[model samples]
Target: MAKDDSDIYAALLQAIERGEFQPGSRLIETELAERFKVSRTPVREVLNRMESQGIASRDGKGGLIVAELSQDQLGELYDIREVLEGFAARLAARHAAPAEIELLKEMIASGKLVEGEARELAIANKQFHQQLHNCTHNQYLQQMLSSVQRSLALLSGTTLAEPARVVVSEKEHRMLVEAIENRDEDKAEQVARNHVKNAYKTRLKIELGW
Candidate 1:
């Protein structure tokens, strides 16, 4: 695709992330074209691509809307995330170098353990996990993990946005890294599994208005 189309798609996705164009919101080609200063042709292409990528779905009657996850789908995604990511951690432990482990350790140590920029903290949290994923050496596993993470968009609210979440999350990250450094497969898998479980707990607490 052209540069303009790429930018428009990114802007649209970011808008969705920010709740500007929320889940189930319609995508009117003309209006989005005007908003992004792009031609309807490119806008249509972007919408088509988003649909194919599972980021959006056809509106049944016409165009497209951001896809929302059902309760069952959310549970399913979490199940897959824990299994795949835990496997990634186990694979990583077998392949990771000392330097890689050290880098992960540093990231865990330096990550904000208290309230701060939510987006930045979330990005850091994501990077730490992605780095662990990278250590796996299996391209297929890497790609599958990426797809599972994209499903995270279905859930509302940043896990990092909650007060005190970073503190708890940082400790969890440390355990994951330590397990990898120790080359303990069971510990790595357990730590990774617990991390997702804790994240789901946070999501539930927030959704329940606790």
Candidate 2:
């Protein structure tokens, strides 16, 4: 890819992940080129790459829009997350350094200070999980999880938006960290899997307006 295409792609992807460009939002090549001070050619190339990655798709009206996952697609994504995240936790239990474990604990502590702030909590939660992914020390697993996470940006809102869900999620994070600290691979895996399961349930509630 050309430098312009790569830079534009990175900026567009970040905007999408940050909810600046929501699902179904139109992606006009001319507008993007204007925003990034680039030519239409590079914007077109970046949009093509995003479409291939399932991040953007033609809206059936000759324009590109951010992709939205169907119910079945969401189910499949969650299933992948449950298995891979559990494996990540198990590996972290075996390979994580003491300093890494301390950092996770510190992150949890910082999260508590942000209680009731949904956006901050959501960012912290992502950081914590990203750190856990790093703790696995498996580059292949990290790469896979990174892709899965990008897909997750398609979902509209944070499960942490609910006060009750936030409380339960923090507890779950503490339990998973404790399991890793104790070097109990089985417990860590189970805790991590259950965490994802609970998150899926919360996401369903949000999606269904329950």
Candidate 3:
């Protein structure tokens, strides 16, 4: 099947996420046009969309580059998300129906049996999170959180990529699921908050060797 501009957009975002196009790596229009087998018009449109989301930036050298997030920028992004997503979890705990809570626990358990392409693993992680948002049952919160996370696309590695880190992440996910299932709103929020906070620190270590 012939692909379209949206496909190119997704391909570019995936490339950025995979570290295939690292922070500050130049995105040559001609190269992208050829790679996506599309005209430069669509490539430019995708680049503009990325820039609006802060995923790419004008390099001032007549080309665009994947946005380079400083340590401070990274901290800010995750900190905002931690607060926002933590509240979302708390709401989900209080308002989610019994079936929704059960489904969450099931997904948490699903993490136990995982092996695949790194991209597939990452995608599962994304689905797990999207499920959490659905549990929240707030359209606005879910929409905003989704937008914020899209900006996070420039990040290369998930904490899940660290050796044995998926084990720890899975454990934390279980805790959050239990907290939600039990309708312990505070505990759910705290656990969800801490989970994201720790992931941010792990990302720092991975990115900065700190």
lDDT of each: 0.81, 0.90, 0.83
Distance from true location, Cα of 129 in model 1, Å: 1.5
Best by TM-score: 2
Q: Write the per-residue lDDT of candidate 1 for residues 1-210, one digit (tens) a residue.
A: 235888987788767766787788898899998898768999999989888878888777976888888777778888999899889989988999898899888876674444368877776777888889889999999999877776676567687787667677778788888889999989999988988888887877776678
Q: What value does the lDDT take at residue 146 in candidate 3?
A: 83
The regions of model 1 sitting more than 4 angstroms off are 1-5, 113-115
Q: Is candidate 1 or candidate 3 better by lDDT?
A: 3
Rank by lDDT, highest first.
Answer: 2, 3, 1
Model 2 C-alpha lDDT per residue in residues 53-96, reported as the tens digit of each score = 88888888979999999989998999999999999999999999
Considering TM-score, which of the candidate structures 1 and 3 is the better prediction for this target? 3
In angstroms, the error of model 2 at 113 is: 7.5
Model 2 spans > 4 angstroms off: 1-7, 112-116
- On lDDT, the stronger of 1 and 2 is 2
Separately for all candidates shown, the number of backbone clashes (residues 3 or more apart, or on different chains) is 0, 0, 0
**After best superposition, candidate 1 residue 155: deviation in angstroms?**
2.1
State each model's C-alpha RMSD to the native: 2.3, 2.4, 2.1
Mind giving the per-residue lDDT tens digits that candidate 3 earns over 17-106?
A: 787998999988899998888888989889888888888888777678889988788888998999998999899899889888887777
